[model samples]
Target: MFEKFRKKSVVSESSQLETLREVLRRNPEDNDLAKVFPQVMPLSAVSSAWPGPIERLGDLPFGVSWALADPQNYFRYVSWDMSRKWEASGTNWRGLAMENLTELSRRYPYAGSKKGADGRPFVLSLLNEDSMGPSRLLVPGLFQDLFGDDYIVAIPERTCGVAYRNGLVGEEALLANDLIDGCFKVGTEPMSNERFDPKRFWVL
Candidate 1:
């Protein structure tokens, strides 16, 4: 009787975990998972408890992960099982993510260009409501379309990004670095403080 009870308890626990969350993908416009976006995260940012492994992005210490955004919630991470299923259904997940990212950028365009105290110009996208600011680095030609070509970006936190034209010199470069470091130190969802040249990657 004791062994039977233990087996029954194990089965019950397994069933409970499986039923804990029922992720449904009824359609592209489904409230459960309509908007899927690509997000860059440090290798250590994710907890081991997560269901999927983050795909490493080149040789960088970051990885490419998927996020699901809906109207009711801020956003949530997508596990490997969910992403694989989405892809197997003939929906190009990466392409869809890029499309959603483009739309998100359109909705919240970067604020007007601002100049540092030293007279160097830069652009900032620091929206507290939008947590995908760092993910902007994954979208090629995005900065070029808005601020022209040859630009570098610093995404210190998930909700903030600082960008400036390439070939910065002297104090201007120092200032950019300082800005990135400062944001990174204080950011809640700290991603990276390194500057990135979007031209290096052919994001599509």
Candidate 2:
């Protein structure tokens, strides 16, 4: 079961990378790279919409709220599943996503850009930090390296806000807010972590 889970995780990361690359390729000339990178969404709007569930402990550390902006707005909320007991097994969830993004860019250099309904170029992934997990330490640099300085959007979750407003209610909505807050940060320091070096990301 453990091996299977690892393999599944790897596959999932690869798929996400490919998806991001495809978006980049479609909108190669798109000017709004900032919109595609990870950042935090505002609480006011998020509070009004589907917030998801909340934890009694308050908030998680690495929560992530993401959206595919452009042709249509699609949203996803991410959090660490500590209940799975992966730490003892030597699994690093953070590294999984980063490695996947890196690999995808190498395999497909012209991903990230695509045309929207308006025929204008647009980026696909728009991430917001949720206050439900550890600091989103790797997000900014990951995006900057994969995309570009101009393309990265590392706004704190307090500013970006959530995309959806209905569907989720009660615990789900509150949980969603906590998740968003956990993922969101106030500045670019988190990206400066050793793992996300802009120099390493530079293609040429």
Best-fitting candidate, scored by TM-score:
1
Tens-digit per-residue lDDT, 1-204, candidate 1: 012112111334345324423433322333234477877766664454445545666655566767787666455567666777776887777787887887777666564355666554565544425567667666666677645887887767656767777766676677667667777776655667777776543444
TM-score of decoy 2 = 0.24
Best by lDDT: 1
Worst 10 residues of 2 by lDDT: 1-10
RMSD in order of candidates? 11.4, 19.2
Off by over 4 Å in 2: 1-84, 109-204
Error of 1 at 121 (Å): 4.9
- Please, what are the lDDT tens digits per residue for candidate 2 over residues 92-187? 533454454344334433312333455533332223222211123322343344335533222223222222222335654454444333434333
Report the lDDT of model 2 for residue 191. 21
Score each candidate by Cα lDDT.
Answer: 0.62, 0.31
